[model samples]
Target chain A: MFTGLCAFPLTPFKDEQFDPVAFARIINNLTDAKVDAICAMGSTGLYPYLNNDERRTVAENAVALADGIPVMAGIGALRTRDVLHNADIVQRAGVNAVLLAPMSYHHLHDEEVYALYEKVTANLSVPLCVYENPNATNFTFSDELYQAISRLPNVAAVKIPGMPFGDKVQGEQRLARLRELVPDSLSIGVSADKFGVAGMRAGCDAWHSVLAGLFPKTVQCLIQAVRDGQGESAAMASDRLSPIWQLFVQSKGGLRVMATAADILGVCEGNCLPHPLKPLTGPARQELEAQLTSLQLD
Target chain B: MFTGLCAFPLTPFKDEQFDPVAFARIINNLTDAKVDAICAMGSTGLYPYLNNDERRTVAENAVALADGIPVMAGIGALRTRDVLHNADIVQRAGVNAVLLAPMSYHHLHDEEVYALYEKVTANLSVPLCVYENPNATNFTFSDELYQAISRLPNVAAVKIPGMPFGDKVQGEQRLARLRELVPDSLSIGVSADKFGVAGMRAGCDAWHSVLAGLFPKTVQCLIQAVRDGQGESAAMASDRLSPIWQLFVQSKGGLRVMATAADILGVCEGNCLPHPLKPLTGPARQELEAQLTSLQLD
Candidate 1:
């Protein structure tokens, strides 16, 4: 159920409230492109910022509008109870899978993390994706922890941070080590959009992508080039968006940059991110617009 | 309002529901101890696990039971909107201050964190404590960022993680460096129960202590020793509790160990920590029980 390009669209906001119209526009772009899957309420969707009701609204809409594409929604939270609550919400909304990051307030131990997945998976009706997002959650999973969690019921995939930037050999070695630990049934997905193609080329099963969320065709072409074993073509396709990747780094992850690009491209409002997360400003905003215009992908 | 020993009691639960009776029992103990202030709903209270309604329940109960001692409630959340919402709830519940951590799903920039404090403080009716707890929040603050945030309205204090373990000179140096950056009005408090004394001896104005949460007299004596300039007495007091400190190290932080001690002493139920945060078990639990018995802390 978890394979290929998993596009993550922003849960668009206007005037500090959810703008379902703008969200449908984003989801429709993914459906029209026929991306492998659409993952709503992922970190790129600002899952943590929204309350359960808002999350349910996004989940129901994403599943409804994906035009028969499989949908996954992030159900990660600080508590097992809330995670279970979110799992029920997304599952009731008919999402095909749920992504759970062991989000924490106190840093979790390996055993505690294992217990979390064990408890969560026991209650889940859908396949569960282990979201190993250390940057956001402060919980890094060791190979031992991964092996333990992947063996749990309904475990589908593990979404890891993108490999060391541009280091294909290092990426392959890391993937190789992880591959040895988990069963073949548990898919290994990669995030961190800048080096996503490197991870895909290194044999990651899916690119759980932020880039694909905004520019579906662009990322799809790159992934397709790789699937066809056209290495140089894949590299060339990835290279075409180097300027945007640089902006992702400059802006610190894709959330702010994606919102800015979406705003500049007229896909969403001028300042779409939830409060405390401002859209790009001044030189950063100008550079993104200039780069987006040059790419001409919109 | 933030000064001296601000005890943080666990919001004890039973049968998967908040045991307000157990909560009040813990609170009454602190009120009887006359700790300088009481901080309910800090990390030790598992603020992240509870919903706003639950948090409000805890806040209201904490204030009602604190007997005239000032109360501070944690209002930190992933979104600024919710932080404000929590701020409103706790303020209405009559907490003297709110503790705001720049809790993140997306790792925040210095500017973003500043914006969060600025926005939150703008709506706050009570003073705000900057909770610079990197271990849980995964967002570290630069000294320059500290300087910027400390200038905001209602910014009362900064609760830092404990100083480097057993390194008094280093603790003092770190505090000195920080002292130069923030206003004198912002009381600097320290957490990490094992090193609470080191932080206090090094000139921290308060200990936002997990140890004080459960064993108020034990921790208060140590602080009182420091206030009297009896360095040897303070060190001796800390050393006497080395067994529990070792347990704190073994358990990663004071939460599990403290919960175990509370259970063994019959202050709360046997498995009192929220679900997914299991109580200490097997040899760890046995060892803690033996150590507590030997210490005759009960």
Candidate 2:
């Protein structure tokens, strides 16, 4: 079973090139924090920006630095072949598993969604995890689709964002329903680092996070507090981290903000987003720095 | 000056793999048409489904088949690096220009959009064309951004889709306004085959189309009628081909429909959309066949 914190490192680029040394440094930092696994090339990692060659290089470096720890590569695209190609490359690099996100030019039906997982898993040697991030990807698979995908032989987990689905009662009901429906062998992970403790208390098996990439020790402590049933300590940790999370999420470009914060925290050398996404402005950067310091993360 | 008809060949796939031989055959057929150039790997070509190697191979085959005729490759992606990588590969394959779509991850500010084109053109040795297909790609670039992109040193043309902005008065006013603002050196091509005659009458320099891929003679006749000011004849051709266009557009999947139509016409061997997009079903196939017959393209 996959447990503990999973750190999703931001991909580093410099001078229109993938910076391997900077990537290595970030992975080393995560390793030092003893993160159970590393998820490379996720939305936070900007997988779409990396071509096949760059993705292969990143996968190789991540697998090497992971040093026996699990490395789950993000494999999702508008085209299934691109995903398959990336999966093949990452598999060759010795990554432990692949996290699949169903993204495309149009909304997909339940069967189409199931077929994607079925086809990918049929050819993949490693276990697969289904990621449901409806915000980044406009298309969200329905519960029926998720149930079908979860039943696939190679599917091992389902990762959901931790934000409340309207009311707390509905959120708890949905969680309880999913927990009851998903097979026991298929682990359930939450992608919400902001409410990691709360999600854990509500019964998520693991916390998948972006902030964990920058402050793994703090994230680890927060998770541990919840695990140990120390509610007050967990709340304090979450309170301290709230400002940083808000800064990262509310910045003009949310993903770009996380990349920039990673640079400020010394987790990566530079914060550069791919084309169409520019760096935060002077005022935005200054505001983010102020928030980071106020949260004592700087 | 890219005047007259421009054909974008559907990228051929056989048994789920890119069929370069079939792709070459389609290009060879377009040579007899009055097409000024051939566009390979555009959205009509199902570009996102192709892997990097397959993309390179398609470019290579397209260049070979076109002989001295210009072949432009679509190099748009969510990431600047992906676009650059594709541009580099296609340039190496001897493509004349790269058709670029602005970053579609989010609605972009003018400066950010300008920066994307500037960065791409800076690295590209070949000329580039700005493809404005806002209907398919949710993010649309403003007129100011298009004007700025046109001023870039290597930009050669702008490809606009057919849908009018509004009523006749508004449409005419908008076109007149654009003509006044945009320079004459940069040609504007229309990708609307259905409204080809109207667009030509409105002073568009060329027609970029998908229907032209299968029925070159009909498209050529339609273009000739428009050029000759035979409005009734051009309208007749448009009416005849309208059903085929509707079937292609209304089909469940864009790429799948094109590939299936190619297969039905015997231009390609089979439907080869990458995963997440399934082939046409029995009902869809029957409907497409009937539509093609009605258009006299079968």
Candidate 3:
């Protein structure tokens, strides 16, 4: 049940406060779309920007509004004490799982990163996903580190960055190599929304997606096509959004682009991002609106 | 008065709490050495790992215990609102100056970074130091960004990463170029302790140091020799500590090694670092002790 499209939603804010009504609207939209799981507080959810109390409030709202679908929350923080503190909070708030990125200010050693996971996983009452996001966290997990972490108890999945595999042969070989390292019980999920179709066709068990948070049916169909072995359909689906993917690349990462898309779709009211992160502005905003109109993405 | 060796002291902790007594010992050591300034809550101080209230207490103690040494506190956070909030706290706690690093989870655009400094500086009653520790913050500041930020109100200094200038000629030229870009009012400070001697000899106005936190007199002599234009003596002083400098290179930016040295020196009780960060272990610890003894560093 945990191994499918896990949509990461933006924790919308209004007047620098968590906008519960706006948040509920987005949650209800994802529920209606029946995404495999709702991951609140992912990077796209601005987990690091929010305090623990705000995160707990967001987690509770996610669980309460998600209908029967499972909910996961990001528990990453700069300190181990805070991560563990967050692990307890989200679990008590009734999340089915927690995603932990080894968030750092000081670059962490491999031993320290492993120790962080070991300490957190030991305290989890629910399944944990080892989030390996080098772009945001600046800590890359080696293949050996991955195998070691996957051996820890209650580790249900490993969310990996998208691979730039040129073809199915490379994609399959890469996934096959990773598969050999971890237990069969561990689901392999791919993020970097642009590469989800390629990853799904590469035989990844799940797509941890930012796009799916705002446009679930769009990504759901792409995943469903891959599952049904319709390679042409999945490829076409991904190809259709090349401009948006280009925008993701040019914007540095998906967080800003996804937030803009959410606001454009009216899923989040405009100007939803927290401070130090504004929505797409000027040409970028105009380009996004033009693309949405041409793509008929409503 | 703002320029010279600004010693960065560890905010020592005992049992997951700020150990003010131990913290006072480190501050007193820097004060006794007559360092030009004491910068509390730097990366060496584990600022990002500390919460705002904890940071407030650390700043208050630093100002109270510094004995009029011109205390500067780090006020960087992931959000602009929080940075402003911390600015208010640290300033109210009576810091003479505040350091802003533009700490990030998502990599920030240059425009966003400029806007961050703009927002924080607009509300500050005290002068600000632009902390450019890319290794820790993961956001590199361009020279143009430095130029822009240096022009902002309250920006008295720009702390740059220590450049690997091979000789005094290169250092002079590089510093001269940077000098042209910023106003004459801005003091240029260099960090990365291994390169501080070269930077100081090359005419950087200040050395923002980690080693100075634990062994203030040791670093003080090096900076002092340069100030007195004792070229041969300064070179010799730096050359004598080649092995310690090599340790900083191996130990990943001096935070861990400083923590270990602090414990060994009894400046901090053992296990002084916050969780997810540990002091040097195994052979690294043994090697640090051997070097300390050989160098007669107190």
Every candidate's lDDT: 0.86, 0.76, 0.88
Q: Candidate 2 lDDT, tens digit per residue, A181-268?
A: 7788787888757767777767777888887766678778888888898966887778777666676566533566666776777655
**Candidate 3 lDDT by residue in tens digits, A1-298:** 4688999998898778899988998889899999899999998998899887898899999999999899999999988899999999999999999999999888888888888999999999999999989988888888889889999999999898886444668778878988999999899998988889998888899999988878889899898898898977888879899898888888888888878887887777788888888789999989999998898652
Which of candidates 1 and 3 is the stronger one according to lDDT?
3
- Residue A232: error of model 3 in Å? 3.8
The sequence of per-residue lDDT tens digits that candidate 1 reaches over residues B1-298 is 5789999888887766788888888999998999898889888888777887898899999999999999999988887888889899999999999898888878888888999999998888888889988877778999899999999999989999885636877888889999999998889998887788888889899999888887788888888898999867888778888888888777777788877877887888777877677778899999988877777652
Residue range with the least summed lDDT across 10 consecutive positions in model 1 chain B: B289-298
- Evaluate model 1 with DockQ and give the value: 0.63
Every candidate's chain B TM-score? 0.96, 0.92, 0.97
In model 3, which runs have C-alpha deviations exceeding 4 angstroms? A164-170, B164-170
- Per-chain TM-score of chain B, candidate 1? 0.96
Question: Which residues of candidate 1, in runs, are more than 4 Å off?
Answer: A164-166, B164-166, B296-298
**How does the DockQ of candidate 3 come out?**
0.77
Query: What are the C-alpha RMSDs, in order, of all predicted structures?
Result: 2.1, 3.8, 1.7
DockQ for all models: 0.63, 0.40, 0.77
TM-score of 3: 0.96
lDDT of 3 by residue, B1-298 (tens): 4699999998888878899999989898888888999999988888888887799899999999989899999989998888998899999999999999989888888998999999999999999999988777778988799889899999999888886544678778879988999999899998887778888888899999888998889888888898899867887877888888787878777888888888888777798988888889999999999998999875
Which residue pairs of candidate 1 clash? none
Task: Judging by TM-score against the true structure, name the best candidate.
Answer: 3
